[model samples]
Target: MNQTQQMNNDAVVEVLNASGASDIVLVCEHASAFIPTALNDLGLSAEARHSHAAWDPGAKAVACEMARQLDAPLVASKVSRLVYDCNRPPDAPSAMPERSEVFDIPGNKKLTRNDRETRVARYYTPFHDRLKQVLSTKPDPVVVTIHSFTPIYQGIQREVEVGILYDQDTRLADAMLEVETGTFVTRRNDPYGPADGVTHTLKEHALPQGRRNVMIEIRNDLIETADAQTSLAIQMSRWVADAVTQSKDISCRV
Candidate 1:
């Protein structure tokens, strides 16, 4: 365990239902908006800390509910994405982004190489390592990363409610999209695609190992309330269960 002490104190990665039996493994990379007290909120305004740039609101709730519903394990990052985006590789510029959307992060502006590396070690590495460890417990696990997208980005309004994203492997994503849900509009990749470099976690964890995977993004407004979050989680849990069963059936035949 190369876990950094500072990040450990913050509980960088939290695993729920570690011994769960379901083939699905849930991951929430932006589960929280907590920045270390020592960092001074990463030099952002109070409003920015709770914004989409810092964390995916309602994502952790959905992931937790789905995990319970499906009897699956969940691995989530506790620190804010602004401190260190767990989804991104250490080398990516946005891994410790100085600017996110329209907000400038003053703390990240003049970072030294060591500063960046320290963040990676303190936050990113432990989160991913814990996720990997959880996945290693199950054979042929389906990786489903839960995320929330702002309805409007940079003044552009996104109409799609659910975005099921995948890179080269689309087994789980294709299955998910095939599930019938008349309530919300589901698309392959609408607001943020693989071209947007949002598939880092799936690519790093699922792609190389040839595991089934999908990155699900829901509009933040759709799940702004607790009732709405639970409703969406119930709907998503059924879809995920169906997708996992279908994918496994296909794999067995091949």
Candidate 2:
């Protein structure tokens, strides 16, 4: 299905609503399942090529919907995470995983130092650099990263429907968690947490800049379709808006 194709820096990174008026900035690191021709589908089977390891299913649609509702800028990666997980740092092993869950990625195994460095330069750098450029345009940006996790990982079931993640700084996460979730269960750092290395994007792009940020993890099953993605984005937009307002109010408190 056209798995082999060329990619440029611009093609790998996508920026939607670059001039969007809102101060919130959205990022979806695992937005596509595209394995460039050079990578040769990462030597994955057809099923593995479209698995969660390749990308976070339906996350890009939800992030796009949220961006439209919030009038915010969104920076997304167009390449598969198997190539390089944009959420991870260059040094992290998961950035280019040899195995994801049950699948052994043949193309990712036995990498020399130069191979790792080359991928870091090609995939990770361009994605984050574009993100930095977008954040630079905003006077006061609040970073919100969007992601989806399988309800069942390695045969274990996860109960949390929405996970709000934070590291050293919890300004945004605290506020978002305080919002009453309706039917869907909401938890603070369930499924994965700081120790899981999921907050690299927030730590790198937002915290040092003194900008409020949070990582959102939704159960993939909840956002499996267009209507579901829209529904989820609508709810998340409310929580994010309220959280931003709450954070700002706390700042202005007398």
Candidate 3:
């Protein structure tokens, strides 16, 4: 709970290493599976509440490790995506989805406009505002959002180990892709892409600012263990650092 700040009564966002010197800013939009006590776990079973539909498993651990290794500030959401997806725009249906994969969200099924707006005002705005505040402090900040994908989605198994995703700007993604990852299978937007509304965070925060950014998706199984998260973080830290250096060089010439 260290470095945790109560952005609202629900404590929607938590920041780590806020004064870190790295130009990179780490974000975990799906960092937690906490549905406010009042939401009643979004009417989901305990199993469903802890499932991938609620949050990106192991993503926060990876992001935290990366922040430590990179000396970068990490801003992460403290509420479940099922309550309100921090990565999505307030207008997007998926922002407050009634269903995720095969699981229907009872609490969200019949939401009125007021219900939706309340969630947005209470959860979404504060999370993004904190993220913005962190990024604003760094000159030419590079945004790196960490996420984890289910190995089997809708019963289909995915083979890609890691995904380097970008919207309009690919400077960081491209450079990271060039870094050899040894056995890890990395691609540019494999499990999800812009079509899946996975890049909303990048579009909203980094694109408008013209900051170098990349959304990284790792298979949840890859980081299922704490040791694995740390190992991956160490490797990713090197790759991201190298990529950031290359991106800055490219920006200087532009």
Regions of model 2 farther than 4 Å from truth: 1-7, 249-254
Per-residue lDDT over 55-173 for candidate 1, one digit per residue giving the tens place of the 0 to 100 score: 99999999999999999999999899999999899999889999998899998898998998888888988888888888988877889999999999999999999999988887888
Tell me the TM-score of each prediction against the true structure.
0.95, 0.94, 0.95
- Kindly indicate the candidate among 1 and 3 with the higher lDDT: 3
- Write one digit per residue (lDDT tens) for candidate 3, span 1-254: 23433526338888888889999999999999988899888789999999999999999999999999999999999999999999999999999999997789999998999999998888998888888888889888999999999999988999999999988888898889887566688888888998888899898888887888999999999999999999999999999999888777665211
Candidate 2 residue-wise lDDT, 36-148, digit = tens: 99888989999999999889999999999999999999999999999999999999999999999889999999999999999998889989988998999988889999999
- For all candidates in order, the CA lDDT equals 0.89, 0.90, 0.89
What does the lDDT read for residue 71 in candidate 2? 97
What does the lDDT read for residue 149 in candidate 2?
Answer: 97
Residue 237 CA displacement from its true place in model 2, Å: 0.6
TM-score, cand. 2: 0.94
Would you list the rank order by lDDT, best first?
2, 3, 1
Give the clashing residue pairs of candidate 1, or none. none
State model 1's lDDT: 0.89
